[model samples]
Target: MEHYLPSFHLKGKLAAVTGATRGIGKAIASAFAEAGADVLLISRTDSDLKEMKEELQQYGTNIYTVSGDVQHYDEIIEKIEQKKIESSIDIWVNNAGINIRSAAEDVTEEEWEQIISTNMKGAFFLTQYAARQMKEKGYGKIINISSVAGHVALRTGVVYAMTKAALIQMTKTLALEWGNHGIRINAIGPWYFPTTLTEKLLQDEEYVKDIVSRTPLRRIGKLPELAGTAVFLASEASDYITGQTIFVDGGMTIYGF
Candidate 1:
């Protein structure tokens, strides 16, 4: 058991996390650092990236920051590849995502483009860039941060759900193609966590009560709970697992009963 337990540790690994300055991304980045991995935090905001780099330095792991936006994957990855860290990215987490909650009928082309480009298109290409680096090393772990709204029917953002669903499918498809290259791709389908994106919704008492009522665990998810799942998926412990979406939804995905 002692021999097997060490596989869960991410010591000496280099991980790149996009949208890593806040919420789920920050949690996952910190978890990687705590597990002994040097993290390359990516965010559109330079200030947030600088601040996050400082905060995670307490873990005694080397922390680096890059100002990049998921929507502009080409520019971002090009810069990353030119840097010294790109050649050895053992883990990559696609944690940058956005949600614009508008009704299907009221959804504008602008909203559609923003959500699709950021959540799905950007994630896929970023995974490709990271996978190429991993392909050279012949081993890697990729985790896509999806949502339960993509799995079950939710009366939330329709366009946001579409992108998430696409991400789930993208994880499966790439896992099959890249398995031989030793690149394992998977996804995390989170329900409701207290992210900056969900702050307003969580503030609504009726919304909170309704969400709790539908969840089998009778609660929303915790940050650590979700981060733990990310850690597991990114670790060698999940070596044989790929192309699967782990729903960290407080049993809400199975709450139809």
Candidate 2:
């Protein structure tokens, strides 16, 4: 057989991304659009969703925004269904997650519940709905935005770590269960990346130095790098890969300082 490069384009594909107005989620959403996929952005804030839609539309791909929360996947799915856009989804990103930093001793039941509900529970349920749609289509891609904290021990709040760890396991289990259906599920485990949420921490010289010292790359991750990883997983280039977590951590997971 003649050799040919595998495709990385997402042209004519329909994708959905949760918590997609900022940070890692936004980067993936924008990348999907740039790769020629029509995107449906999911978020709790209507204003943010609207703003992102406008930004993504410039890519010349269809940009749809659904104002909803992952905590209620059924309702959010219903909202998308009403718009008659749910069935056509080809890529679904479970990126709606949250973290609460608190000492283990000071962790509250409310905080634990909130983090668990949003990160693990919501993602699982959303994956269920997205998988259902993909099952009907006979093939699809699901990318979970996990974290380096999931695979290693860190000072990241225990509850947040718990949720991220669960996501890694969830990715494996779901891939095993769904692979026969032509759906591939994988995750991206990212380390420190400059985002609105971590703007202050990244600006602190001491913290930056500490982070750089620990990472083999000696630098923070760029948003496009993470986005590019997402694009690969979302495209046919990654069709044969599943149940895997690719760390976009700048080697932070390897160095223990």
Candidate 3:
């Protein structure tokens, strides 16, 4: 029997992840580092970046940090350009997002704008910049972190679902346009992952039970489970796959009630 698992290794590759200060983003960054990829971590907080960089050093892969607000298109473009001068990006993860859970009738204009600008607008511009560079090289992977809410109407905010659904479409459109250029665009939709955003929900016994009951796995997702999906999408193992949203939801989306 011959072993052929080396294709999954990200050795010698340069990967970039936005929202990498904590939660799913941080997990993905660390997974890439452990797989031998030099990771560029982006976040709005300087302190978080410093802390993450220190924690990631154990993986032995070169780690770099960029502090910027992704909501500003110009800032993201500038940072992408600067990073490009250093190394060609092989994998780009658009993981920066925000959600304000409120009923549609209760959603304020300000809340709507903030969610759309950060989740959709920011990801779009960043993808444009990354895709341009990838087009030049004829090889790249772009991963957008979507959510299960996008697939079905969850009790979560409608604006969040809208943004994520848009992301799924964006992945498909870009993949079709750039497949000839050796670029593969894809998305990951996570459900009920333990993160700062869901800290409150996780603490509520009723909400937790409701979530687990719906999920076939009967439990909330682990952050590392999300990381494994990301690693698969970022590496050569998924070279033939593109434009698909892989839901890491523990069967929540598949279960019907």
Alpha-carbon error at 95 in model 3, in Å?
0.6
Error of 2 at 183 (Å): 0.8
Q: Of the pair 2 and 3, which is ahead by lDDT?
A: 3
Residue lDDT tens for model 3, 1-257: 99876588999989999999989999999999999999989999999999999999998988988889888867867865776546778899999999999899999999999999999999988888888888889899999999998889898999999999999999999899999999999999999998998998899999999999999999999999999999999998999999999999999999979
Model 3 misplaced stretches (Cα beyond 4 Å): 1-6, 83-85
Instruction: List the candidate 1 regions with Cα displacement exceeding 4 Å.
Output: 1-6
- Ten-residue region with minimum lDDT total, candidate 2: 80-89
| Alpha carbon lDDT at 109, candidate 3 | 95
TM-score for each predicted model, relative to the true structure: 0.96, 0.97, 0.96
Question: What local lDDT does model 2 show for residue 22?
Answer: 97
Clashes of 3: 0
Score candidate 3 by TM-score against the native. 0.96
Candidate 3 lDDT score at position 209: 94
Candidate 2: TM-score?
0.97
Deviation from native of the Cα of residue 234 in model 1, angstroms: 0.8
